[model samples]
Target: MITRLGLIKTSLIDYPGKVAAVLFTAGCNFYCPYCHNPELVSGPVPEDFLSMEDILRFLEKRRPVLGGVVITGGEPLLHPDIGVLTGAIRDLGLEIKIDTNGSFPAKLEQLRPDFVAMDIKTSFSNYSRVLPSGTAAEQIVRKIRESLKILIGNGIPHQLRTTIVPGIVAEEDFDMIIPEVRGADSYLLSGYRNQRTLDSSWAEVDPYPAEVLEGIAEKLRLAGVPAQIRTN
Candidate 1:
């Protein structure tokens, strides 16, 4: 029973140019305060979770109209049966994109989804602040580094993302991350929304102003990084 915590029957923005269905898997290893999907992160899976059979049946019927599926989470890679879910989606002849938190490099390398969108939460130096306290910081850093290596080495159609939370991620942080992801396929910066964050205090944190985000995007573009601010 792969936990299908939430589902968006249709989405125009998840899979790049493809119209896709978004499936939310449950549980995440990280405890980023800005995470909006707290329910899927640590809360119980909602009673309305669609079973694997149910999702497959829906896909079978929608396959003719949808181009692919976007398997996101709380961190889809946290699920041990992620491969099973991806395999079933592949069997339906629709492309698959997994939105992960860049913590499961080996699993990602092995599964090889059609597209991957991983979040680079913060600079390596400030990693501990965003991740859970007392976490094995060095190990987590290594995993994210390895995931970046795998994505680039395998030439996976992927995008590296960052959410610009006002206090957690600043414009200067981009200077640290840009070099690491330099010359990658694409880099996206998303403005943080605090309305439903994992931490209640985060709800009071202000998002970066629009001009600030766009300014950083332009700076990255000028620096030769394929950077853009994702509006969706």
Candidate 2:
């Protein structure tokens, strides 16, 4: 079952050019230290988590005001019944956007979302730093690569994003990432927040300044990738 952990009745920034409802799902494959929604990453779903029916009912009522729905996580794609959830949303005539880590290429290819935001945590070579110890980092990297191809080849409107964490990702790493997402529709560089991170120690780390991130985005644009910085 897909666990519906939280919901934002309305959001203007989560979905581009639309006033949308945001659904938060539970569970994640990667354990990035700077993850802000650490509580949703693992552990049992809270007793009060809304049932799938509850979520659909809520959407039904709000259909008149909402332009779309943003299904985010804890990697929404991790849930086996994610397609069912998306299908239900689509039936409401609401556009759907999914936020993912791009770890599940096969599953991603099965669903058609109006928009996709895939986090490129770091260079594929350094993915081991965020994943579990027993994970096959190389294999996961290959899957991410495949997912990228699926998005580009299918002509999906998507953005490749990376949070500029202090130590986890440096400007140099973009050199490796550029080759992987060279032809992506867009590349987003987000400033990291140091609070409520998955790893408490990450709170002590400083994020890159806005100018620093702007510089990096400029570099990406010069290299032929459409790059933008998201401050929120």
Candidate 3:
């Protein structure tokens, strides 16, 4: 029984060019400030988890109209049963896209989602403070990097993304992340929204403009990293 906080029936935005339903799972491994799903991040999972029957009912009803399902989360990898959920969805003959922080490569290997979108936190990502002290942070990143290699080398239909938190990252952060994923299929430079954040300091900081994001994306593209600039 996975804890679910929200569900969007159709999202052109989340999955990008696909007509898909987005299911927002509760709980996250990291507390990123710019995270918008505070209803999920700021609280405990409800005792009444969303039943598979309900999800299946809805999926069956919309099976003709919708293309697929996109399972996103604070961190879907935290759930041991994600593979079960996505496998069930695949049984309905629909494509699946998973959005993750890339923390659990082993679990992800089991899930085998049709497409995946991974968030690559910038160097400014407060590894020490936001993440649970010491052990958890390092291990999560190691798995993320390893899975990133697997996804790229095996030609998974995936995209890598990094949210631009203004004033947090400069030119140098790319130096750290780009080398790891230099020739990725697609890299999305998303502009952070100035709203609810886990940390109060984040609300005060402004987000970078679209042009600045484009400049950064262009630089990455020039460095042999294929990416696109997407601002909302």
Candidate 4:
């Protein structure tokens, strides 16, 4: 089962240059303290989740108006029926973007989404700090690195997103990431907003200043990576 947990009927901003509907899948492998969707990640699945039939019917009705669909998660690739879900959405004549944590490069290559928005969370050195306790740090990092290679090597339209969390990511961390995504086309530095975080302590933490984010973006630009700071 795909186990869809939530759906946003319409969004002007989730998918770049397209009016899209966002579908949130339940469950994730990572246990990021800064995650905003804790409910979808570790909490109980809501009983009111829109069934695949319901989602498809709605998409059919909004076909003329919606330009695309964004399947985000708790890590969308974690679900076994992801390819099946995407196939149905693709049949609707709308582009699909899957938001993921870069855990499943093979699945992504197989699905061949129109666009992929993958989170870089933190520098590879800090993976153990961000991932769930007891996770194989080396293996996961290797997988993430492989995912990046798969996207860039295949020329898949993708964006590498990094959330500018206060304590989790510092100014120097970008230095470590610069070489990793040197040839990337798009890099988004998302401003962290502390709201209902997975770790309650993080809710009291503040985000980096706008200038701090700009500085990080500048570093990426200087390293030959096209970067943008997204406040929203």
Question: Tens-digit lDDT track for model 1 on 10-35?
Answer: 99999999999999888888988878
- Cα lDDT tens digits for candidate 4, 1-232: 6754578999999999999999988889999898988888776777778888899999999989999999998899988889888999999998999999998988988998999999998899888878888999889989999999989899999999999898778889998988898788799998888977999999999888899999999999999899998866
What is the Å distance of residue 113 in model 2 from its true position? 0.9
Taking all chains together, each candidate's TM-score versus the true structure is: 0.96, 0.96, 0.90, 0.97
| lDDT values for all models | 0.87, 0.89, 0.77, 0.89
Candidate 1: worst-modelled 10 consecutive residues by lDDT: 1-10
Clash pairs for candidate 3: none
Model 3 C-alpha lDDT versus the unseen true structure: 0.77
Model 3 C-alpha lDDT per residue in residues 1-232, reported as the tens digit of each score: 4745356878888776779988878888787766766656647775554666688778888878878899887787788777778887888898999988887887777777889898887752445444654546666678888889878977778999888886556556787777888768899988888677767678888887777788878888998888887745
**lDDT score at residue 8, model 2, on the 0-100 scale:** 87
Model 4, residue 77: displacement in angstroms? 0.4
Output the lDDT of residue 73, model 4: 82
Clashes of each: 0, 0, 0, 0
Sorted on TM-score, best first, the list reads 4, 2, 1, 3
Worst 10 residues of 2 by lDDT: 1-10
Candidate 4, residue 216: how far the Cα is off, in Å: 0.3
Query: For model 2, how big is the CA root-mean-square deviation?
Result: 1.1
Model 1 Cα shift for residue 104 (angstroms): 0.4
Give the distance in Å from residue 177's predicted Cα in candidate 2 to where it truly belongs.
0.7
Residue 194 miss distance in model 4 (angstroms): 1.2
